[model samples]
Target: MKKIGIGICIGIMCFSSFFSYGNEQVLPHHHQIQKGSASYIETINQEKNRYVNYGDGYMIDYPSHMEVDTSLEAVRTLIKDQEREIEIYYDNFHNTPNSAPAYKNYSNAFIKNTKDHIKEYENTATINGMKVHLLKWSRKKLSKVSNDKNFYVSAEIVKNDKEVYTIFIKSSRQFYNFEDYMDVISSFKIIEKKGNPSINTKFKPVERKLNEETKEFYYKYFVNSDKLRWGIFEQSAPASFSYLKGIENRLDYEFKFLVRYQSLDVPMPLEELKNAYNNNRYVELTLQTMHMNEENESITYDILDGKYDDYFEEYAKKIKEFNHPILFRLNNEMNGDWCVYSSYYSSKDTNLYKEVWKYIYHVFEKNGVDNVLWVWNPHDLSFPNFKWNHYLTYYPGDEYVDIIGLTGYNTGNYYPGEIWRSFEEVYPHVYNEYMDIFEQPFMITEFGSNEIGGDKVKWIHEMFDYMYMHPFKNIKVAIWWNGIDWDPLRNPARIYRLDNREDVMDTFRQRLKDYK
Candidate 1:
């Protein structure tokens, strides 16, 4: 019966793509480019939506409000799980006229850089807009023999004089034609923002607090504080600067200062890390301690081995050198039987994990890593109290800790959206209680969605929406665990392949620039 049901699901999903890919284009008059930089003209005449405009193009419109970037040189918009991006580059043939042949030649090069899943798919009339040369293709097919394979993908490409664009949409093979029903793809348009854009217009930030009564999500209130609220979000280049401006407008506050992680490659000795923090580049130093001890060994033996202490001494010197606040999270998410640290410290042995936690904290203090702030982070549970005791069972002394953190990820067999919804239902207010007891800043140290669907763009938006509305006032930093072996469902060693998805990376990076 289960096998039959799974087969039926696969069949139905095959038709899912048409809904996102088969629509005609639509261009609004508001999106018209002002006659400047280059000649500008537009025409829109489709029953549903189809429009075309040409000039010094600056902005692009999408059929849906997706995670989008509308910078001038490059434009990208995500529709469901599909991503369409156009990057403009100068073509210097001097007098070489702009033609489809030249465009196809360049397109072929772009296609070559990608996997064989994409082939020259099709060329068709673009909704109500000018004719566009379109090519469609798919990624390597799924195999019945192995669990390791790149997630399936399909793509659409379009080219013109100013830029050459490609749309790479990813999904399981079950939803191969995902773009077929998407309204944005067939009916998208680009236009330029008008007027000499002003130089420095500082923004007023909007604040929001969690509204329990609503039950649903909202982002229009904040905990008013005498001291200005502080936050951290990363940025890239030109677009990143624009995103920063947008954040400033929404928050009405300049960052107190910036703290960049000096290095993520090799483990820093406690001494060197402290020095960097003391210099004031950033206050908090996050220590990853899972690899510091041996897994599957007696708790006493592990501690007496004195491995963790060696690293603590090295790390302490660095923390004291900078006089920086340290966010020390050791053996995070140990309730789950995944890592050597966590698996050995499961719910049954409360004393074991706690004793180890204390030993490390004591070593740090004794070695002068006192300037550091400690955080106790754990995984979210489906059955609230079933494993509730595991959360505080091994909690170390009050003198040794400052913050509590939680790691959450969506883990369903299929449907990323549904998986995310399940997580919210499983552990709704656990963090509020964590803060109440600890009375220190808390954080979602690691959070991400990894079920089955390909809608990474939507996943990011929903996550930010939740972060913007957590009830706890101290729920401060929310870092997406970008570490390679963090996925709970798959083999940890192979998780590195998942990070290769360029679309996922872009969406994640954009959130960092926007939310803080």
Candidate 2:
């Protein structure tokens, strides 16, 4: 829940198979990996393993099996025992300044991290007149056993006068075939549209250590779960648990997490965090980098320049002290204009945004603050809403994010120019867009229908109706924002509370039966 400017998956709709869950046909996120199905992995010596993607301009002939988990992001994964995934992604990156910092020690998917995470094994070659950077890394989980295997990652970056295309191939050590990456990577060909557009490749492994919060138990649990986890942010604090109890009574269910907001200008709000956790609730903290409305031209850039090092370090330490896992959303809704950290305030350069994001994550990493899962979120709607200001343009890349946060509020017809929007109008398209690009589970970090525009009760029913009709395979959590936004004249304008009326609350409770 944000004051104003806040925003928030390979959403792989992979290869799917429907199985009977009691009276219903259900499709879980982790379907059994098989050949010829949507989890299409080519079988060795099988022609079917070879898949060509005509959407972006590329084609490939993979070995053995093909695994396409369209539910979360990769185009395909490989073989029966072990797995390999191929993803062809296009970054609107012909405009990126040569000066911006990206994920992992200032390098993105195309460049190497060169840090303590992935062991660096780089290969740079000159092909004809083109300088191609082929970054290859073999990352092994550091264990004492000498026979332990490692996964391999390789990628290519190609750009013309338009889009920057990245070809990434990853080999899972589900079984050790060290040369697995070469089988598929060598066969990738970019179908040229113009006379001669260039193509290049590079990739490094993405690895991080957490303080006992294994990715298996936390992230994958959400990714594989079929149930929806509900949450909320009531307007009051300290007494928020009291309000949450009342909200639970109204909704007839318990919340998975309680949302909390904090500004980075202060030390971490350890007290508020403890307050939430003490009530036996998990916490999702949306940490804004600036003191509201005080962010100037230099704030985020100064963060890039190391202005708040001591503050952030102390903050990270406090979070580590909290011990429990937290859904950490930093500078969320970053693509929106209302946020101080958005590119709108930074010379319209989003690289500054990514750099600051990477900077803060590295701080947490350096401090061994591993109980937090990083959420990369952009608002469902952009404020300026230009191509340059698009949500994908602000992505820091996949390696740093564990969850994708979705925030789209039906602000209702409260303020001027705000119109009545159906529940259908708010989510489906935005959720689909993220599914095409990211391989992370999504959470509606905060959203609610205002009572002003139309029937809030009908809106609730429609929200659940759309869910039953279309399975949102990657969405694991949905948090309602139970609060109000005051108008300029200081009146309660957007009444988003679900408990205001008996009918509205009853509608949410009734319709929520199937989803939760």
Q: In lDDT terms, which candidate is top?
A: 2
Assess candidate 2 and give its TM-score to the true structure: 0.61
lDDT of 1 by residue, 1-516 (tens): 001111011111111221121364433322222222121212233223222223223322333322222112111222222332222222222343444455445333324433333453555556435454555544343222122122322222233553433333333333345354234344444444343311111112222121242112111111222121233423221113455444445444443322233322345544444433343323234443444434343333344346445555665565555444445566666565444444232212233455566666666666655344566777775211212124543455455555566666655345232333443443356665554345545566655555354355566566556655653455655554333444456754312122346565555555556544
What are the runs in model 1 whose C-alpha is more than 4 Å off? 1-267, 270-296, 304-315, 342-347, 382-389, 412-423, 469-472, 483-516
lDDT of 1 at 128: 38
Residue ranges of candidate 2 with Cα displaced over 4 Å: 1-207, 214-221, 237-239, 293-295
